[model samples]
Target: MDRNLIVTMNAGSSSLRCAVFERGSDSPDPLLRLSLRGLPEAMIWERKDERSGESLEEELTPPKVDSDAQAVALAEMKDRLLAEVASERIAAFSHRVVHGGRDHTAPVIATEEVMTDLDALSPLAPSHQPHNLAVIRDLSSGFPGIPQVACFDTSFHRDLAQVDRVFALPRDLSEEGIVRYGFHGLSYDHVATALDDLAPELSGGRVVVAHLGHGVSMCALRNGISVATTMGMTALDGLPMGRRPGSLDPGVVLYLIEERGMAPAQVREMLYDRCGLLGLSGISSDMNVLIQSDAPEAREAVEFFVYRCQREIGSLTAALGGIDALVLTGGLGEHVPDIRARICGGLGWLGVEIDHGANDAGETRISAPEARVPVFMIPTDEESVLARDAETVLED
Candidate 1:
């Protein structure tokens, strides 16, 4: 059998998701998917065969060593993929890079110059960019001659309005690239395309997509283009994430440094690693865990999450004049029905009403029949976006 494939990798701070897709005329055909979560301390590796609908999962304990556990996991993943498909038949390796700054508004080949430019933007997205680029570098080294493509999360919001992109700071800082460059563009891009196919009527209308997961963000798509988003110059500026404290006041940051005597690096670490659901609940960062817990702290954390999501939805709705459709994607948004119901419960004034039965059954359209705005649960496919962008770059 002819086997031409593209491998797409999305590496987060603590997890790595890789998939194999066969080259197709319209869209890439998935062959296999692999993910390694709960990294460093312990890794849970899961593999699914797209063709056979079979899955296998196991815990991977790295040998105690000074070397990086993530690198070892990536190398192991590469070996497993190679065992199934030959290196020659793998057309390209695509990646989801978290930031691209101002100039890189489109997918591009990961050349030396491109890598250098992306490296400079790492400080803006310290939690994600470093790991993403590290995976790209590792893949480039492992697959010497194969082309590596970078699909930026910021690229989809490249056309964001000037008002949406500007900060209240000095004009010179904005010119220096300290402006809103929304994250989660890959997921948003997938949802936009899916909407075009599934809800053509709502595709060209105003839409708001809530991408809730380990890293959460919302985007306002005006006729399928990002006009505004919750995230700003960094991913940390958006909705609170699994371990990130999002949208904190600038004054609080100052207070931490001046009053608390915390260094900038310490503050950054706390914001990126110790805050959010984990910090709030004093439990796991996983939303599923928080929901299952009966602790008041956990409940409050969940409530805060939903509250922030509703507020952001309202904010994005205003940005789009009004929301015609609301899309829920990402892990939590797609899986948790109660969370969805809670979020939509407060949006009744904004014409958002969801059918509890439909939502409970995990139906696609969860909105009430008499609702003015439709609510959809669309599972996002960031890998497909990466694959398509890789194909585009290869063609170019």
Candidate 2:
């Protein structure tokens, strides 16, 4: 238990988010958060104080041109942050891995064999797994003897029913781990636990949480356990994301390959890098930008995003048999009030009503007093969950 600092990392394809937490018995105390983004070209590093909300951002000197350089930059940044800390002992380095396949339903120590197995599952999560592992490998080599843990984003949905996990494929295929393993479990886990303190009534009731950031997904929870979720097999299977197509017909891929003579890699790049808000609007992939533009394409993209979210709410509502509450979290879910309004507009049948003023003010409870289902806006903290898991595994 002498490990002084707990480093929690969530590495994406384009960004690496890290938080340093002071070791504690229950929940670790947040010390500082560092975000390094734009790894491909010019890397931008941002440092924020967890308690005071103070922030500072600067460009990475020499700029990380590729993943290797990015790893080095991260290592250097970590060392700099450690120097600021009074202790040199790092207890553990925890990661937010996107998929755990089937075997890893919980956090596990990331040994060499574990990293190899996770690397094999990279194709299943092209955007996250590789980068996540890269950081792990980097840290492992740089700081020998430090404990590392991998917390799967899919681990939260391990309790989903068999029917919910199946893909209507042959039983043999399902047995081979080709089932609908949901993503964003880490975010959902945070929200689920946070609800007890934030809204006890809705926390114990049937709740559907929508995590709508650059990556979007929804989950249905009964008594704070995952019942069903929108994402399946891969992150690309659910609600449209910042760049992902989301829930496309399988036949579309066949058409692109057979009729249009497209390569699988080409299609993958298009789907993962150039679709959704960007493809639909022919504009930037960021929702903030799309929301501000007055162009018709921008409007169409925003409308389509809202439409898909509305449909997902209905699907998840059916899964829960009814809706007691709806919670929104993530970049767009928390910051953009108009998107939230548009999503709640068509759910009047479910007795969902938004208080315009409350919604705009970013209040916790945005639903009207008389509404049957109360909607809440809560920020998600996946890093905190990962940190606690690291503490548990290390302690155990």
Candidate 3:
């Protein structure tokens, strides 16, 4: 068996991303990548050979696939991999679990009891937790004896000051695990480690990393550790995202229930799938689409997103006592120049200045020469982090 091979899986609501890495003594080299997205008519499967940088895209016929989405997708992925390489090469399966609750503050082997306890925490991360667990369970059932390590997204923030993790509620409720536990930690951890190589001088200084994607959140890093973050309690509590309404006033929720007579389920649906940029623009949840649109509503949505990001940057800056460097990662953070420029424009007073030419050119360091605080665009490597963690757990 190729014991050095590790498979890392990231299960989303409608898609699954998996990567294969060949681990060596130094670091792992990525082998292949796969993404499966469920569509109305059929499933769209995409695969990339990192070695050759060649990609293949195809649609899976429904008649040949199982009705269960997770089962069919995993089966198809297995078939494709076996066709290219032997199954014995796969050493272990690593999963990106969204919530680790209060106790699972590190990666652990997914035993039956562990899975049951993790499944119980799904209500806290309705959109993500279930899907993540589904993949882990499926792999466990399929591979049987092969170890599956659950690397939690919340584990990175386990060291948050008790004051930061506390809630303004009854002590009983607070002690019942109803406290701030940030998400997107795997992504943030990748960025945190990359900072030293990306900008050595600023790596040890105060840095705020913005992981903006369909699920958006910002983290404040002091000396490469999470001191504060935008996400709290759940993924939905962070900055406004593709569909989630972020940082909503609790009274609005009470009003929806007591005054409007809306059920909790309906309110939950609205908050998780009907709000954010989609609700604001009545357009696409995609930032690219919103940026290209001339509609005033679209402009307003984009403006509001930028405004919120700017506000959070200020808050994180306060948490750090000051700002030294700002690093943007993830889809929207790395690619959308206009959004980054807009977010940084309002922060010029804090010695933040973007080099328009470099920013537009998509350079790694986009800060102006005279700018006191440097800005960087670093792509996150969550799968690599998962693979490394899984390997470590397996070795242990």
| Local accuracy by lDDT, each model | 0.90, 0.88, 0.88
Per-residue lDDT, model 1, residue 82, is 82
- Candidate 2 structure quality by residue, lDDT tens digits, 1-396: 366788898888777888888876454448888888866666788889877889998987655344475566667667766766533467889999998998899999999999989989999899889888888887788777888899999999998999999998889999999998999999999999988788887789899999999999999999999999999998998899899989999999999999999999999999999998999999988898999999999999999999999999999999889999999999899999999999999899988999999999999899999888899999988889989899889988
What candidate 2 gets wrong by more than 4 Å, as runs, is 25-29, 38-42, 59-69
Per-model TM values vs. the true structure: 0.96, 0.95, 0.95
Query: After TM-score superposition, what is the CA distance of residue 296 in candidate 2 from its true location, in Å?
Result: 1.1
lDDT of 1 by residue, 310-392 (tens): 99999998888988999999988899898899999999999999999999999999999999999999999999889888878
Model 3: lowest-lDDT 10 consecutive positions:
62-71
Which of candidates 1 and 2 is the stronger one according to lDDT?
1
Q: Best candidate per TM-score, number?
A: 1
Find the number of clashing residue pairs for candidate 1: 0
Clashing pairs in 3: none
lDDT of 2 at 2: 67
In Å, residue 295's CA in model 1 sits off its true spot by 1.8
- Model 2 misses residue 13 by how many Å? 2.0
